[model samples]
Structures are given as structure tokens and as C-alpha cells.
Target: MQVNATPNRRLVVGISGASGVAYGIRLLQVLRQIEVESHLVMSKSAQVTLAHESSYSVADVKALASVSYANTDIGAAISSGSFPALGMVVAPCSIRTLSEVATGVTSSLLSRAADVTLKERRRLVLMVRETPLHLGHIRSMASATEAGAIIYPPVPAFYANPQTIEEMIDHSIGRVLDLFGLETSLVRRWGT
Candidate 1:
């Protein structure tokens, strides 16, 4: 499970109070398989969502990543602009978290780390999990995009012929990893 990138390349993963907690967990699993060091931070509401959606405990979730940070730990290294992370991903990004990052509000370490990623000109990918997006969401997306963040909603890809939820998760995270220039064979690409 050797990573294709530099040995110490780091990726920060944030989990918000979104429906698809599996995406964040699976992304961690895939990152471990690829030997990428992961710095994981989970919001308080994200813990509730994980309990509602899956049987895994917070300890289990934390174990998936190489390092775990408290969501309220604003002093964490990942929350600083000087942190040399290659990128950050907010998988299953809740609308609330998305709005916070879009407006540059750093109420939590997750949002602050995302803010630092953008300010540092590093990649920040938001896997927005909300549906029926309103005008506010659209505006936030636009604003984040303007700030060089990529908004990737977890929409299913029919071309991938996903037969199960795991397949769908793999496909979406694989594409997100592609944005970070990480090579993965998790999902088959179209016209491949």
C-alpha cells in the first residue's frame, strides 16, 4: 500500500454532520491502503451522524486515520496556515460546514483548517452531502470556488455501474483523490 506521492505527504480529512459518514470513513481506509498519512478531525455533530448511520465507534473511526485531532482543537497544527499538508477534504460536508468555510468563519478546527488550506493555496475539496440545495448553498459554492476550493457533491455516477454503497463511495472518493493528483484504481473510469 505504498503511496505514489512523497513518503510524508499529508492529507487532512474533516467529517461534518452530513448523512454520508461512510464516505469519510472509506476515504480514510483508502488513504491508509495507499500509505498516505491522514490527519482526521470530526465535528461533534459528525459523531452523532456516525452513530446513527453506522455501528462503528468514534475510536474505530479515529483508528482509520494515521492521526486524529479534536474538532475543537483550534490550536492543532492542521488549523494553522503553516501546516505543510498537501490538501484537505471535507467528506460528507454538511451545508453548515460548507457555509462556514465559504464565509471564512472558523468557529471550529475543521472550518479553520479548511480556511488555512485555502489561504495557503492548497487543495480543499468539499464533498457536499446535502440535497435540494437552495440559493444560499449555490452562493456558498460559488464563493468557495472563487477562493480555489472544489465543491464535489456525492452524486452517483451511472457510468461506474455501482452495485453497492461501497462501490459508490469508492468511486466518489477516488475521483476526489484524482483532484489531489493521487493515482488510484479504486473505481473504473469512463472510456478507460
Candidate 2:
């Protein structure tokens, strides 16, 4: 699984309270397989969502990442622009988290790190997962974009013709990793 990323290149992963907890989990798994280091932070609400959505425990999820930071640890290493990560991704980002990032009002380390990524001109991808979006959600997404963050909703690529949920998950993740210049064959390209 060795790939484009250097072993030292780090990616910050934030998991918020969204229905699609599996997205974050699978992202970590894929990162590990490709030998990319991962730093993980989870909102407290994400723990609750994980219990409702997946069979894995918090410990199980935490184990996937190279470093796990407490959401309350606002002073963690990744919270600073000097940390030199490739980027940050909030897989299945909750609306609450999106609002904070949009307003630059960070209540947790996860959001704080996201802010740092944007301020440092590094990649900041938010997988906003809420549906039936209203005007506020649309406006917040615009704000995040204006701040140099990429709003990547994890819409399924039916063109891939995924036969299983895991394949669908991998396809979505592979595309997201592509944003960081890491390549993976998990995705079925349109023409290869």
C-alpha cells in the first residue's frame, strides 16, 4: 500500500456528530493502509453517534489513528499552523462544526485545528453530511469556501457501480485522498 505520501506527511482528521460516522472510520483505515500518518480528534457528540452508527468502540476508532487528541485539548500540537500537516479533513462534518469553522469561532480542538489549516493556506476539506440543507447551511458553506476551505459533501458516485457499501465507502475516500495528492486504487476510475 505504499503510495505518494511521505511517511512524515501528516493528515488531521476530525470526526463530529454526524450520521455518517463510518466515513471517518473508513478514512482512517485507508490512510493506514497507504502508510500515511493520521492525527485524530473527535467531538464528544461524535462518540455518541459512533455508538449509534457503528460496531466499533471509541478505543477501536482511536487506535486507527497515529495520534489521538482530546477534543478539549485546544492546545494540542495540531492546533497550530506550525504543526505542518498536509491538511485537515472533517469527515461527515456536523453542521455545528461547519458553523464554527465558518465563523472562525472554535470551541473545540477539532475546529481550532481546522482554523489553523485554513489560516496557514493548507488544505481544509469538510465533508458536511447534513441533508435538506437550508439557506443557513448554504451560507455557511460559502463562508468556509471564502476562507479557503473546500466543502466536499460525500455524495456517492453511482457511476462507479459499487456492489457493496464498503466499496462505495472506499470510492468516496479515495477521491478525498486525491485532494491531498495521494493515489489509491480503491476507486474505479471512469476509464483507466
Q: How do the predictions measure up, each by TM-score? A: 0.95, 0.95
Please give, for residues 129-155, the per-residue lDDT of candidate 1 as tens digits.
887989999999999999989999989
Indicate which candidate wins on lDDT: 2
Give stretches of model 1 more than 4 Å off: 1-8
lDDT of 2: 0.91
Instruction: Give one digit per residue, the lDDT tens place, for model 2 in 1-192.
Output: 322344246799999998899999999998888888899999999999999999999999999998899999988988988787799999989999999999999999999999999999999999999999999999999999999999999898999888999888888899999999988989899975
Residue 89 lDDT (model 2): 93
